[model samples]
Target: MKTKQEESATDFLKLVKNMKYFTKLKSDNSNGDLFNVTLKTASYNELNLMVSCLLKASICALKNDNSGYSSASESGIDVLLLLEMALQLLPDEEMQLLDEFHKNAIDRKAEQ
Candidate 1:
């Protein structure tokens, strides 16, 4: 049987997967029915998915509370930096796409 911590970790992973899927559906202008399809394409270690989830959670927290940025304020920034660092750990094409996606997200936020 799994320990409580392990169960919690599993639950967190499921939450992240669902959150990432929902955010992608919202941003892609695609049908919500495609949420599972998009999520199926994500690997457990996918940096893009992880970063996307982090961005979504951060934005949600910022909108719902007046706590300000807190120590977690730099999470999205840290995710971007980690993606850059992960370039050495991932394939060239994967890294290139992630860079492009990151740039597009930043551009979209700037426009907003």
Candidate 2:
């Protein structure tokens, strides 16, 4: 049996795998879908999937409302915070590698 944290992580991973696009529809001029997101990693994409899952989970928590004092909202936020902390445990070099990837990605886009 899996612990709550494990279950949460698993749920997040599943969500990320099933998600194909990300967009914020705001106006009639919107293109519906914005950026093309993909995850690549040395661990057969496991690391990418984990990071993507945490990011998506955090976003989901933010989208939940607390104005009505909903318990679910609190739970969602807690999950996000915990996952963020877990990610922080990654080695500094790993985080730096992630930063480099982002920088290279932007540079590639600039050439387009």
Candidate 3:
């Protein structure tokens, strides 16, 4: 059986593939999704900078939430949801490392 990480990796790949088609579709706004356009047009360095900013934001969000894992805080859940989206922007190796870290965190929470 595939490990959870393995399944997650597979699912991530599928989502990336699906995003290609979604990107092709026209948005309701005439501007046509500025974020999507930026992602498509940005240089490698620009994209890297954007991802770094997102990581910083996620860290700040995570740090602001004080509630212990046993009792989920609204902010904690929001941070996790944001982190999930941020994970998609990361390179595979970094993504895997973060993914493992998150899994370990959840496992530790379950132990408490």
Could you say which candidate leads in lDDT? 3
Total clashes in model 3, counting residue pairs 3 or more apart in sequence or in different chains? 0
lDDT of 1 by residue, 67-99 (tens): 664534444344444444444334568778989
* CA deviation > 4 Å runs, candidate 1: 1-89
lDDT for position 42 in model 3? 58
RMSD to the hidden true structure, all candidates? 16.9, 18.8, 20.4
- What lDDT score goes with residue 51 in model 2? 67
Q: Can you give the lDDT of residue 17 in candidate 3?
A: 92
lDDT scores for all predictions?
0.60, 0.64, 0.68
Better of 2 and 3 by TM-score: 3
By summed lDDT, the worst window of 10 consecutive residues in model 3 runs over 32-41
For candidate 3, write residues 1-112 as lDDT tens digits: 9999999999998998987855655455657554332246356567677777777877766665543533235544566666666666666886589899999999999999
Q: How well does candidate 1 score on lDDT at residue 105?
A: 100
The positional error of residue 9 in candidate 1, measured at the CA in angstroms, is 57
